[model samples]
Target: MLESVLKTIYVIWYRELIRFFREKSQWAGMIMQPTLYLTFVGTGIASAMTFRQAPGGTPVDYMTFIYPGIIGMSVLFTSMFSGISIIWDREFGFLKEILVAPVPRWAISVGKALGIGTIVSFQGTILLILSPFAGLSLTLWTALKVLPICALVGFAIGLLGISIAGRMESMQGFQLISNFLTMPMFFLSGAMFPLHSAPQWLQVLMVIDPLTYGVDALRNAIYAGIPEAQAILQHSIAYDLSIVGLFSIVTAATGVTAFNRQG
Candidate 1:
């Protein structure tokens, strides 16, 4: 049974990978958005505003501060939209075939989430190439540390998209719902600005946003080498990881439940 489950997951994951590779346009579209934001938006903001509190008082600029948030943004957008592929598969009658297969439905959900997560994580990592431009000093060690956090954030967000997609029959509907959710999640996640000085109502929403912890975790990892990192971190690394991990578990279960219902 374990072997069967593993094989099913592999098949589903491989299929998603093949589809991703075949769609050459996806690479450009995904990479371009973050590049534009990091270059245009980041540069403009960095020049206009002087960030008073540089982590460790080490003169971290606005661009450096928002880099991890930009990575989170990339992961968020890519992972959330990835579920639209499910709608496409359904439209083409491919999902029906998969649903009728003898394998466990949960395995299918896990595989789909993992596949989307992997793709999103890769997209986030690609943004690391812009670290220097963002005024961040990144090394091989920093990249290694940042990779898994990106994967975890991607996986959690992918499961969320899968859970929503499992219930959505139309691509338009899925896109609409995802758009409604993505913007607020990104803004309140402290991606573009610090949350410590946010308004009370916004702070309330920030705490509830899973991406907040994911972004914070990314910041924690990215700033790990800086002195007095805690000055910049809202929570400890372990705490941030715990929240994102819990979110992933909850979303994974939700995705599996959605699949079971659909199946």
Candidate 2:
């Protein structure tokens, strides 16, 4: 039984991956916005801005502060809506075939999340490669540390997407709802700006956003060597990791439940 479950997951994961890579347009569309933001926004801000202190109390370059946030933004937007494919599959009648298979709904949900996570991780990794241009170091240690963190961020957001998309019937409805959710989630996450820069109401919202912790974790890991980053991060790496892990698990379980009930 365990073997069968694993097989089901593998199959679902493989199918999603094949669908993604087969479409060259997916890669193009995914890369375009991040490229524009990194090029235009990063450069534009760097030109006009003097250095400022992050909410963590450390003085950081505007580019450095926003780099990780942009990474978080890229991962957040891509991963959170990755499960729109679930709705697509349903519309095309492919999902019915999967639903009828002798596998647990949870396994299928997890598999789909993992596939989307992997794809979005690739997107984040591409941005990471470009980070040096934005003034970050590209060491082996940084790469090793960042890869896992990116994967976690991707998986957590992908699970969040699945939790919504699993039971959704209409592609139009999914897009409408996802657009509504994504902007607030990204903005509140401190992706474009620091949480401390926000008003009190927005700060409270940031505290509730799981992506806030994910962005915080990425920033902490990426900037570990910087003296100011060390000074500002009152919370340890463990705090950020725990929050993202907890969010992923909760969202994944919720997705499974929703999928099971969708029948």
**TM agreement with the true structure for every prediction:** 0.95, 0.93
Kindly list the per-residue Cα lDDT of model 2 for residues 163-185, writing each as its tens digit. 88886888888788888988898
Off by over 4 Å in 2: 55-59, 232-234
Counting clashing residue pairs in each candidate, in order, gives 0, 0
By lDDT, who's the top model here?
Answer: 1
lDDT of 1 by residue, 195-226 (tens): 87688998999999999999998898888776
Q: Give the per-residue Cα lDDT of candidate 2 at 231.
A: 48
* Deviation from native of the Cα of residue 235 in model 2, angstroms: 2.6
Prediction 2 global C-alpha lDDT = 0.81
What stretches of model 1 exceed 4 Å from their correct place? 53-59, 228-230
